[model samples]
Target: MSRILAFIFRRRGHGRGWHWTDIATWIWLIGGTILMFGPALWLVASSFKGPAQLAEFPPTLLPYVQQTAMVEGYDAPLPLYTTTQEDGSTKVLAEIRRIGVNSQMVDPGNPGERINVNIADRSPVREIGLATGNYVEPLVKNNFLRFLWNSVFVTVMATLITLFTNSMAAFALSKYRFRGRDGVMLLIVATLMVPLSVILVPLYSVVNAMGLLNSLWGVILPTVATPTGVFLLRQYMLTIPDELLEAARMDHASEWQIYWRIVLPLAAPALAVLAIFSVVWRWNDFLWPLIVLSQREHYTLQVGLNTYAGELNVQWHYILAMTVVTMIPVILVFLFLQRFITTGIAGAGIK
Candidate 1:
């Protein structure tokens, strides 16, 4: 451990000792790490706490519950507490019941007699405990698996369609020089400034006219053609030499063959970047899915998560637990494809 710490703090370039820049860099990194991961850690911790623990003021860092003991002649376990006696010594006692500011406690060893103590004179004995039920109960009671499947289907289908359609649009816009092509590209790019909220009603009308309401296809089809994706892929495809396509054409290759064999292979990094973006966007989208799918059976994960909130109460434990579950896929996708992001974005602007 000491050697590892020494190596970590070691100065680069044969410096004799630590420098001020090194100290600042380490401080900045540590602070950044805390800022990034602290809320996630807190969410995980809070997910394992029961309602009582969650409702406590100035929440604890770890899940905690009052310790309980099975006292003699009691049918159920009783909560334990440490009470300060008249002689200023403390004794562990099991609580029977509380009335007003006083509590009736019993010695676990001698359960026949009850001792009265002021609530202020005693504090409940608590130990770290995880409420696994927060994770289990929701799965058992709700249609969690169906919701997960719907989300997965939407994300996968939408990503594939986004990649295919965007790449095709990009191929044409970049390689082909038809009249009004610049105007077409400008119109597509300009759509980025138009917020989704502005088009929701018209989009919904189109989906409704097509009889796609309450259908997963409605969610997947409407969002597959994204201007951001077209822009990204087109910019990247522009960097590919036109000579490559001409060479393929000279070898008796069709346009589709050249696109499939030459262009896509070279633009893999950009496609990967677009794929990651599409997956995240489709998976986390809530409003469109909520508006389109009225039936509970067709609800996606984001829409399904809202069911935890009732008119009078919100089941935060279930919400937090399921939220953690929902994040696992997005996190895994990012970790898997994160390597291509820098390369793809940089290469896109080279031309």
Candidate 2:
């Protein structure tokens, strides 16, 4: 009886006893994953799609491979159909559009022997040529590789600056007690409520005053003093016990040494989390970069990608292809630092 009962409840300890709520949780997770990843998958797929395949009747997920579908008529694009020629011999005729929905066969080399084929009795064989020019053409024509390099430079520099400044500020705020420190902290947190748009004009004026206009330095400098980053680092740093710092101090470690050696090493997890956020923020940054830099050579990947658009038509294939390329760094950074984010957030938030 015990064996029988055990066999019946074999999964009891495996997944918290497998309630209906577990099924609901799984449904929600699968649904959320699809929702988040579907559009990104579509964008990558669309990058490889040909122009005709973009509007194909039955939507295709994979890129349409260039294949020759038979062309029915003449070299000049005509529909093919079976028609009886002069000797009652059947010849295939390629059709040309006529008035209304009607179509007619082009006159053969001899205009006098016009093939007036029936509207319903033609079996047209195919001859459609396929082209896959989008992916390679844009990169070659638009100097996209240079833009990619510029984007990489900007993202790396901005993330490094933000990490250094934010972490230093966080260490001071979290580890030290000073007169008016609470007020300074309050002021920094208060900046979070103010949107960047509200101060754009002033910020630009400041950048211009420093003679950083139309430079990468202009774009990188303004973003370094992020209030949110300071707050996040402070929260994470607060979780590090003071006893560790005191021991270092007893060894005659200077304030800067204590911060550089002791605090930073212990705060690696939080720094990793911050680095991920900083990379994503700087990588996707477009507006400021656009406003600061005007020269084509200096343009980041996002701004340079705008050159593909025109008043007449937008080249979606180029846009999609470049967008996928631009996203690679952010995805890689997240993957590298993802393990630290959850743990750091929990430690910082709870402490």
Candidate 3:
């Protein structure tokens, strides 16, 4: 009987422990999800609100009321007469008489009277309203379509160039058995240690000398040869079997054929991952493009977004709206290629 009681107690304790662990895991998962997506949710919500709703006194989490104000004629000082009665009652007679402007009095017998007032002009009070005009006006005024095109053009071109350059370099390092190969690999790895800022001035001079400044190629060319890309691709390429290349060689296949048919297809997952990285980096790049490109027609989406923030007043709602729009493409790209990123990284161990 005692043995039976002990076994039952142990089983109940183990079950309770598993239940507690499951509950803790769920709490952590839900909290993390909320923390990650909270800002994105807020930005989307604020995009629909106006400046007043955005800058409401003691800010509102959700916009409940729309505030509107209009300017009316200014009020002038008027005279008032106070009379005391015998019973301690006071009567105040207020006349609508302007101190600065002239007024015309009408006689009780006369119905029509004309008057002209020559007074100092009061400054006009600006009216504030909660309207969608602020958000719509900027997109129409600023050529947003052109800015978007520029962003896509730069990102796509730069990403393609980076992928091609990095993949080729990676393949060479992985498959070739030439002298100084290790030294070359070391040199490329060493570049990852050097910050790009150190070479910015020299790079700028080179680009300027080549007359690439103010051109889209200027932005695309500098970022094409990335050390990180080469490193990532090389690591993945190491996993490819040399016997495959030898087999292709026995079939009288050229190096280009081996790369295109055998290696590239095998490396698709890694290439996709690299392409995603390159596209995202180039798309969101702001400072380099701002420095290199001067023309309004050539400005990328990020540079164009900067124009919304002015010296005196900033259009926060418009800025947030544009930001939300800009992030959509990157998010979409990530969603499309996320499988590649995860699978590639995981399969890296296999190779």
Candidate 4:
């Protein structure tokens, strides 16, 4: 009976241990979710607040308070008369002051009338109401739409060019065996070690000579050939079964046909992954675009966002609003494409 009791006690302890492990995993998941999403939640909440509520001490997260002040009636500047006191001192005053709903005139019989005044409803101060205009103003004032268009243009064109060139080079390195093929691959890979800054001056000179400075092409042309993209795609392509290519060749498929039909579709997942990276990189790119394009019209979203940071004073609220706006596109792209990345990596590995 003592032995039986001891075994039962041990089994109970093992059950508790498993229960604790399950609880730990749940806690970890909850904590990670909060850490990842807390700032974004705060930003979205803050975007709805009015300026005063946002600055309130002991800071209120919700915009529930509404305060209003009365000014002298609506004649331009609302006339305030000066009264000469007995000793030649003069006083100026607004006609009305309020405590609760009741309001009293400063001087019972002032000539000017009082009007209920409403301050322009500025952007949401606290985390309560939506201030649509705060988000809207930056887009209109800064030519954000044009900047967006330029960013899209550059990203798409550059990504397409990068994909085409890199894939072609990668296909050559992967499929063809010739004298010095391995040496050529090594040399191409070696270029990846060179820092982009080292070539900026020479690249700038080439763009300037071509008269492409300040042009979208200048931003697109230099990055059309990325060694990283080539290297990554080549590794992926090597995993493709040679038997498939040989079968296509037996059917009298040309090299281009084999690449177009057989290789490209099988390589879709890897290409999608590359495309997402290319788009995000080009979209967020600032320094290169700043160096290449001097014109404001050609500025990308990243460059345009910098205008909010002035030499003398930074408009923190406006800058924050614009920043929130700018992140939307990147977030959307990532959300849409993130599903492909893991699958692409797995597919590439299988090949």
In candidate 2, how many Å is residue 208 off? 1.6
Tens-place lDDT per residue, model 3, 207-268, is 99999999999988988889888888888889999999999999999999998898888998
Per-model C-alpha lDDT, please? 0.89, 0.75, 0.72, 0.71
**Whole-model lDDT for model 4 versus the true structure?**
0.71
Assess the local accuracy of residue 196 in candidate 3 as a C-alpha lDDT between 0 and 100. 58
Q: List ranges where model 3 is wrong by over 4 Å.
A: 1-14, 18-29, 61-136, 342-351
Could you give candidate 4's per-residue lDDT for residues 1-351 as a string of tens digits? 999955644434346544666657767988999998888867766665555556667755544433222443534332233334456675443334444543333332454654332222112111234655667776787677788799889999999998988888888899889899989888986887775688889888999999999999989888778877887788889999999999999999999999989988888867878898788778888888989988889888778778656536665555667677778877887688766655755654421
Decoy 3 TM-score against native = 0.70
* Better by lDDT, candidate 2 or 1: 1
**Model 1, 89: alpha-carbon shift in Å?**
6.7
Stretches off by above 4 angstroms in model 4 are: 1-32, 50-59, 62-127, 342-351
Per-residue C-alpha lDDT of model 2 across residues 194-264, encoded as one tens digit per residue: 76677788888898999998788898888878887888878878999999889988999999999999888
Q: After superposition, how far is residue 239 of candidate 1 from its true place, in Å?
A: 2.9
TM-score (C-alpha) between model 1 and the true structure = 0.78
Clashing pairs in model 2?
70-126, 70-127, 71-126, 71-127, 80-124, 81-122, 82-122, 82-123
Q: Estimate each model's TM-score.
A: 0.78, 0.72, 0.70, 0.72
Question: In lDDT terms, which candidate is top?
Answer: 1
- The RMSD of every model to the true structure, in order and in angstroms, is 4.2, 7.3, 11.4, 9.5
